[model samples]
Target: QATAMSVDCLGQRAVLSGRRFLYIVNLDAPNEGHRKISRQSKWDIGAVQWNPHDSYAYYFAASSNQRVDLYKWKEGNGEVCTSLQGHTRVISDLDWAVFEPDLLVTSSVDTYIYIWDIKDTRKPTVSLSAVAGASQVKWNKKNANCLATSHDGDVRIWDKRKPSTAVEYLAAHLSKIHGLDWHPDNEYTLATSSQDNSVRFWDYRQPRKYLNILPCQVPVWKARYTPFSNGLVTVMVPQLRRENSLLLWNVFDLNTPVHTFVGHDDVVLEFQWRKQKEGSKDYQLVTWSRDQTLRMWRIDSQLQRLCANDILDGVEDLIDGISHLPEPDKTLHPQDSEPQHNSGHGDEEALKEDFLNDPLVGKKTDQLGLPQTLQQEFSLINVQIRNVNVEMDAVSRSCTVSVHCGNHRVRMLVMFPVQYPNNAAPSFQFINPTSITASMKAKLLKILKDTSLQKVKRNQSCLEPCLRQLVSWLESVVVRRTAWAFCPTLLSSL
Candidate 1:
């Protein structure tokens, strides 16, 4: 299997591999180390999304499936998808809507909108959109069913009840609208970009012709809604000397530039607020450039990060402010220090049991503080295969990670271009299998065996594939940690 990309939680690592498949590589190092627990590969992953609330389960969109699939591995991974089906056009974007995780939407380049009762992607309870290119879809944070979209040069908003209700229609720009997003706090607010020389915002519920318009020197690439509720962030390509640059503005009035992010050598394709750890002091900004580079920009100040965070009415709120959630619930007005959720927080027995039972959470918590309700099932990862040492064919550019404990041989041929990073030393990485023995493959197979979190099970079944389950795990292997914790420093950058 080939992976176009992969993403993992402190608990489970997922590989978005080709052949339209996803492999869950259970890991422990939210701080310590990554190891494989179990894996199940299914569907052709066009898009894969994790439940922001929990890491064990996830959603994937595929062409053959023609539905949004949900999975939960707790009770032996099976399709939670017996009833859920979404989208008619090879489901494009599937996400637990930011405002409500229960509500799910999927779109295809084919002009159709299918809103499914997330429990089942197998069917769409509501639908909309005309015969046109439906490039993007987004819901108004305050108003769930109200959707805004970009189709060529038109920007339109539709209410669920009246799918035909074009609450706000604008033949806004001459060229295709490339980006559209809504401010979390401001209902009826919309920001969009196109080939036009300007990025514009509109207040649909109001009578204003255009809420505000900021000039763009070049055709804007894409613009995102800033965390400031009503502000907007726009990316544009600069003339010859450079390919592109980004601009941030307060769309509420659009009179002044709040921030300008420069230094990108190519067009910054997209920008997003990397939701920081719930209670941690660290804050980050991410921008993906066409130059095939992902740059991590640390928001210079703590207060600055708070200001750019996605809290409505902001961090001063007594309870609703997400960034300030770790503090006491002023709404309840506790008499002393805020009580945490753990039943016996300091009880070593309970903690030890929790960690042993569910190593995923213990490790996933390395830096990204997890939500209070999160929990997981127990798993032993990386059954270390130390006996049959790694046999690397260095001259052939063949590098692999495997567990060669005596007779068992489970391995993943790694394809990282060895020339990228500084001090890219060669070291053997094992998936942290479990209980290695002389006949390692068989014992490892039994442990690696897994099924889909969804209900549908392919007629095909075997125990061997799990040998090299094709998963990635996280481990607290960092000796001297820094801001860029996960990626190793490349000699090129060194």
Candidate 2:
């Protein structure tokens, strides 16, 4: 049951390994021009990967038992270029260096990791000795010399220049780590999924504490960052052999999965993102399952938005405005630590009492005083009222609402005070192009103010609630006026 697969970096080809052969299929045309190379091997292929560098796009490596065979496929013909033989036990994983085409690293149960130069396959060019065998290995995408290896529940960071010892150690998980992935943009950041039923994000600079954690009920087989936005894809160990275990999460807010991928009849063995094409907003997720089927899921811009943190964009602008000031304290005190989502939020009142105390809102209150929480609310607000149009500007702390109910068009500007959502309400004022009567306007304004006050007293946002109240009242007033006119006509006819 050899079921290893890898897609080339160019996104043009994919190779799937089986017991008797390696099937190479063109991703652009999966059904045609497919070819297979026969290989006689007793052990299953444990891992396979294509060279990530563009120049070496035709080369790939597959490990069967303890030996890794490097294959070259070009012009519809394929053959084994060379084979590396050093590990005493099964090879667990291998990775091609992101920056170096000639460097390939492999981890094995022999408790030795080898960095081989394909030019000389006689033996490994360098060997790293460890007490426990590594289950996974990956090169840092942002740094050429940095790499990481996972041994049981621990992780070791290494610099290729220093092979004598690991530079840093992280006790990442209590259970065995099943997956490790380095962040696309940051070299210091990485994610690990473990059998402990949790995926934890780590900033390796601070090894003691994790940046965040995503807890699941079942063991996680793999968790990897999306190539596009702030999304993460996780494949959980299937329970009962029929559960839908693939889930997509928004890294910033791990409250719920943004989407779930269905249709895999069996467990997903391997999954990888296709290299994004130039000038395209859509992404393709390629997954291979034990059901013996390969599937591609398309992610459009709309679905991508669910994974984005809208508040971060506005917060970055606020941070830039105060660049001249001294940097904020980097030391994270126990009180200022990250709040775990699974734990109760009873103590969160102290940190979230006001916008100024918000962790993401930042300490630059003197410069902009804008709260990122407000921006996030605007992005997620539902504005589907029948005759209402709202224009919200979180930066200015104001929203303009226009409503049309029967010949009356009311336009008002609602401005929030500085102490908003902390027992301070917004002010509502009617603007030009308002065709409503004085009595109607006064009644509507009173209702809006009361709605805002009720929510603000409880330390909650009031913009969306106020808009909904306005629409509900306006519709009721229109119905009453229509009923009065109909009553007079009915009496005259009788």
Candidate 3:
């Protein structure tokens, strides 16, 4: 049976690792069909991964006893290009950098992780030694320099700039960690499965403890976050049964699985979420099992989209329920009752006219209201709002405001409709700090937009949460830069 398997980023091919042969399957033409690449191995192949950057390269790496083999596709055949040798023991796992086409990182039972440049395989360009042998390693999807490794019960986060020491370390599991994967949308969030019969979620920004834990009665062999949703898929080894080991969970609500996939006659070795097809509204999950068979499970669009919003709605409902409880006092102090007024109506009207004349103004609104809910939320946080220009047409409402949070400044254009906090969702866009790279800006906007939409969908004011997240990210960036400045060795090397 194959012990390791991987699907290419493009979802066009899959590679399965067996004892002495590698099976490459053409996903697009399964019947035409599979090819076997022969290799000499004393033990089962440990891991296999395809280059994530360029589909045209068709390059992949497979790890086995003390070595990694790099192969390139030539006329439908995998030709061995190079062999990376460094580990003194069996290699455990490997991953390709999301942004670097030729960069690969492999972990081994020798307590060492090697970073290789596939173009020059004479030796690894960088190496990291851990306290214990590592079982799995993964690269951050959003941050190029950040990577993580799991050894025994500890998970260590490393920044490539400072390879000598880990940036953050935490005792993640009570037993051996079997799988690790980062959240697709959040750079700081990661998930891990363990032999301790549990799955854990962590935010690297908070190193002392995990963000969430999913308890299972059976040993979890693998847990992975879905590509476009907050859902997680886990493969568990049931104590008395081999069937119904695959479960789909909503991260926010772990009390129950949203759905369970049951079909495998034996334990699932590995499972991964395939890339969504263009114009398709659903996602496909592929699983390889000890049954010597592979199966693809299709998740409908409704299930995927429900993950974030449903979780947020549950939170909103809980808050609403708590807020309805009796309070200790009914009377407000005179100081707390002081009236606040809008003082710049004239300037706002002028700005509204200017915005209305813009070519991008697809819709307009005139009935714009500054909800007291938003005002109170902002005041409690002491978030400074500057250059507030409110505008509206008959159909839509919007405002351009500059937020001052400590030393960070963010300018955004917020658009709302009359049914905001009920039926319509708000939009947020960056209007200042045009200096940020396109990729960075896009990620920022995506987080903000998702957050705001979730809030509005719950009929709650969103500006506060959106602004809070932005400020938090900015603060984290500053902290990272400060830490980097103190590493003179890293600075000199760079």
Q: RMSD, model 3, all Cα superposed?
A: 19.5
Residue by residue across 7-84, what tens digits does model 3's lDDT show?
Answer: 888887778788867778766554444677887768777788878765534888888789888888766788788899
Error of 3 at 361 (Å): 30
Task: Please provide, for model 2 over 1-494, each residue's C-alpha lDDT reduced to its tens digit, 9 standing for 90 to 100.
Answer: 43888989998877888768887767665544457788898878899999988899999999999999999999988899999999999999999989889999999999999999999989999899888999999999999999999999999999988998998999999999999999888898889999999998888877888878888888899999998767899999888885544677767656455555655568899888788789988887777777666666667554565555443433343332211111132221223236355311111011212332363544532223222366655654555545888899988988888999787788999898878878999999999899888988887887778667766765666676577567756654554354211122211221
RMSD in Å for candidate 2, one decimal?
15.8
Off by over 4 Å in 2: 312-339, 342-494
Each prediction's TM-score against the native?
A: 0.50, 0.66, 0.62
lDDT of 3 at 99: 83
Stretches of candidate 1 off by over 4 Å are: 1-95, 206-208, 229-231, 237-241, 252-256, 262-267, 278-282, 290-292, 301-494
lDDT of 1: 0.44
Number of the top-ranking candidate, with TM-score as the measure: 2
Sort the candidates on TM-score, descending order: 2, 3, 1
lDDT score of residue 263 within candidate 1: 40
- Model 3 residue 410 CA deviation in Å: 58
Residue 75 lDDT (model 1): 31
